[model samples]
Target: MPPTLKKSDFHYDLPPELIAQAPLPERSASRLLVVPPAPAAFDDRGVRDLPALLQPGDLLVFNDTRVIPARLFGRKATGGRVEILIERLLGSHEAKAQLGVSKSPRPGTRVVLDAGGEFEVLGREGEFYLLRLLGEEPLEKLLLRAGRLPLPPYIQREAGADDAERYQTVYAKQVGAVAAPTAGLHFDEALLDALRARGVEFGHITLHVGAGTFQPVRAETVEEHRMHSEWLNVGAELVEQVRRTRARGGRVVAVGTTVVRALESAVRDGELQPFAGETRIFIFPGYRIRSIDALITNFHLPESTLLMLVSAFAGRERILAAYRHAVAQRYRFFSYGDAMLLFPGRES
Candidate 1:
């Protein structure tokens, strides 16, 4: 490993006002910063010009995990307002969630959700509270009608009618993610069609982003940080496609960090394989990547694990320089911000 990267190495100054409070009016209208393979080559483009930028044979991998309405507001039996954000489902009717209220609800305390459905707090599990549903319908179905869209905290607005549709990607199908793959949100049907016309193949893997994604790294040292494990699945068909793409010397372009983790975690002995389970791979500047060749991702928070992952993919210094350029160019930052097309760099 490249001499255990210090957490301080990723630090940068970001203006509070630059953090995107709202998504772009048009998804594809978001800016794109193209970080070339080397420092000598620099080209900046708009997200709409991606089709002309990528080669014909490149395989653009995407995360198809759908964002669920994990945020639910309800009233405690004692008349206090309570907000519940589901973290993950433990069983058919049991789920783990983060509760926000004036006072912590104890076990056996009942809270009435939307449409009069109720949930009883079972107990605490680590940082999350265990909940048991009291109705016959599945939690997924109930949440669809009753819960609100769990927009990122950086977006300083309440969930609106448009957020339910706008926050999600056009390709989102499997329902599990608490957060949308922001990079994929830029691609509309027209862009997909345009990419297909240019011979860019597309495939999907699922990585259900948990609410833990928003948790900031508490460790001062990079090695001291324990990355959160998120569930991922890469099927056999996708594996076969990847192998075929490799055989033809086509580049594998991952759409988001979630797709990168899903692909890399599924590779064994340098060969891609079908995989399903949790992965806590904490990528930093020293880690050698064995799967993805290119990355399409959004601007990330300074000193964040996501930023560390990108720095690991590209050179840390190069990524930092690119970030400086983005800041100077007035590009938006965070989950709903502008994107970068990165070419993986050699490990130092």
Candidate 2:
């Protein structure tokens, strides 16, 4: 392994212009960068070419977590601007959210959400504020009526109506995630049907991505970083699918970093098992990944944990080199950007 790992080791130079602000006309029309396990030349392809990238028996696992409308503009009683992003629902009537306000309201203070939904601030919980809905409707219903889709911070634009459909995956079933499992965004019905016809097996896991996913890593060294906790559920069916894939000499391909964490968290004791709870698993170099053999993911923010996770799967230097190549090639970067099909490196 390399010497002490610094967060700076994951940093890369990206042109701001390369950040993708919008999705393409077709979901599967995005570009695909294929990186082999060996440290060699990379191949440029398209997302639609996934049908040909894997063998018939390979198992593809996707995160079925649905993206909720978590963002909204609100105001404190004193008229201070407050932007709310629901991190997680504590229950039917309560939620914990990240509030963007100059001065946070104290407990018992009421906030008027942009669309007139009212919520009472219960208290502060670290970086989040606990809130209670002031009406009979559940928190989810209130958000649907008043909130806008919380696009990533880099996407400089208001959430338009079109984003409601494009920002989510076609297979989103479990409703909880604040953010979409972007890697799955590239797989439309046509791509899914094609993969199924090609004999690719499918499975799912759920990991409700939290707002902390966008928070920048504050630690100077990678080891000092504390990963955010997210709820996950990995069932016995998927574990058995993985075992069957292994028996058939097929690979397990995780659709996104969320799925990677979900699968890895299921095997905390070095063996896959059913799991349902919060996970704070942090993947970095020197961490051997036995969960999935291949990964389908989008380009991630520089110095981001998602980038670090991908670097752990492939070698850090090779992944960074691939990032430089993607930059030179001018492939769109981040959430709504192009994707990569990666095979694990020797260490992984």
Best by lDDT: 2
Candidate topping TM-score: 2
Question: What's the lDDT for residue 223 in model 1?
Answer: 88
Task: Give the poorly placed runs of model 1, Cα more than 4 Å off.
Answer: none
| Residue pairs with backbone overlap in model 2 | none
Per-model TM against the reference: 0.96, 0.97
TM-score of 1: 0.96
lDDT string for model 1 (182-294, tens) is: 89989988889999999999999999998887888888888899888789999998998888888899989999999988988998888899999999988887777779888
- Itemize residue pairs with steric clashes in candidate 1: none
lDDT (CA) for every model shown? 0.88, 0.92
